[model samples]
Target: MKNRVDFIDWLKAVGMFLIVLGHYFGEPFDQFTQPIYPKQLGVAFFVFVMGWGLASETRPQWQVVYNRLFPMYFWGVVIAIFISLIFMLTKGHPAITNYLPFIGGINVLGNFFPSNPTTWYIGTYLHIILLWALVMRKVNVTLPLILLVLFCEIAIRSIFIEFERLFTGYMLVSNWITVFMLGMYMHQQKDNHNNLKALLIMVLWALLLFTWASLLNPLNITQTFPFRLPVEHSTLISSLVVSVAISTVYLSNTLLAVKFFSGIPANPVVRFFSRNTIFIFIGHMPLYDVAEPIALIFVESGWGKRAIIVFIMYVGLAVVSELLHKAVNIDKLKKHLWLRLN
Candidate 1:
């Protein structure tokens, strides 16, 4: 179990890195440039990891909600304010409108959106955690219930155009429950399945995704959302690929942990990646958003210059995020604040 958990950490490390790449490159696999992994799938994988963590911890609902919600609110608001201020300082203007989403202060109804593009996930995550908390307390969390919730979310979006615009037109918390539930289900059923079976399932999902990708309008889902599908993919396809790939890793890790593939020691690299994923995911975007204009001037059609800039931005933000993560320690601060407020 321990080694299996380690494997999941490794998977998350890889997934998080892919997320950074996906956002930085912007539709990395969309063009026929190369046969690359779907970069946008990274966020979906993160949510999968979230579901797994929820299953593994099995803490009280309030505790789970508190732990997840506060960091998002705290850091999300901070990052929004900070970025808005940077824009204001650099461009010489008031940035209140840019920062409004951070504090739930949108002008129009159904427009309570995050100003930072990446913070949308945090908002979606907040919704998912709250919904899961409420549902877990009310009834047994069956597969049917999971499907029902997903269906309801889709139905609500279909019925209300305004809400869809507010919470990203395509990939809302509602649309994502399926993948999140898949993660929870994977964790709950980990012991019952075998690696070979999981691999087979992954292959089947891949084939299905490929077929669907050929038939669907890929951008239909992401047009108004945080991320659009690469030119020829759909949400269903991406979700299936993300869920199956993560599940495959879980099964493979479990197998390897039991000496299926021996002689691997502690993976410090993977540990670093997992440990700093949150920071990497949150920090990379703003760094790139700021550096992109500069990169364009120095980056002619050459891969070397562009690649170098990417590496520098990623590493620089990672170091800063690590320092901030340690220095701020939001969990402890939240506890302190809660104690005083009560």
Candidate 2:
């Protein structure tokens, strides 16, 4: 069995790239890829990949939790504090209320949601991992079982729309349960040589549904509002759309295992992007605070100028990521924290 799957790495790199570009597309870049970047799709692909990775670990151990889960929380807090400082400096008072969502108060009342929109992903990811830690200790992590859990949550939400919509909107453990499980299933079948037929079926099914949904309503392709944020959720249509998108990426990589993508998992560039996905994800939003203002100056400067801005943003961020990787060394710090805290 292969230790590293290049296609998975490729998919991760592509997904993170889309995510950053999606967040970056506000002023100057919005026109370049309006209603096409599929931000939710990138996030969904990431969650699915996470689930795939978690599939092998039936018993959620402390070391894995400390290593894998702590970074998001660590960065989430760091970002939250950073934002708080900004708020104080700019607004004359550090508004702790604004940062409430970071502590699981995003959409508790069914209407009040993430004021700091970027915080939802990391916060919800933490909740999902914590739940898995507690529950997977007693039960097995499998596709059917996860599907049942998803169905039950869906049913409950249907019954108590207001309550579920309010609470589950932010604490999204149950909302995306199905997609996460599907990711685990993907991991389970990683070595399937017969995946070509299944991949074709998934592609066809995805296309058919997308076309059908688009013909009836094109908005379906781009409309994902999980937790009242402009992010993807675990709705039936969304689940299918994201699942197919991820599968397509994986299958495409597998089928076309040559040229640039060949041995890509080991390639330094691909490895950097794939491994630093969380860093890119967390850092990009803040970087946008700076990049957006600069890009806006060149908003009307034509495509060539806009293209340069995009390239600079990508390269600058990549450099920062590399620097951050070398400077603080997040993994080592997390391990250190775990040692001290434990």
Query: Considering every candidate listed, which one attains the maximal TM-score?
Result: 2
Tell me the lDDT of candidate 2.
0.55
Q: 1-342 in candidate 2: lDDT tens per residue? A: 337766567667777776655654534422222222345456656667676676667443666666666777676677667777887787776646435545653433334444355556765676666655666534556657865766655554443333335344324555556656666666654433345555665566556546533543423333223322114444545433443333333333323332233333346787777876766666565555576567667675565545545555566666776787688878778768877987
List lDDT for all candidates, in order: 0.54, 0.55
Q: Where does model 1 exceed 4 Å of error?
A: 1-4, 31-39, 56-58, 97-113, 157-167, 189-266, 293-302
| Candidate 1 clash pair list | none
**Cand. 2 TM to true fold:** 0.70
The TM-score values for the models, in the order shown, are 0.68, 0.70
Model 2's number of clashes is 1
Regions more than 4 Å wrong, model 2: 24-37, 58-60, 95-115, 141-143, 157-171, 191-213, 218-266, 301-315
Please state the error at residue 70 of candidate 1 in Å: 2.9
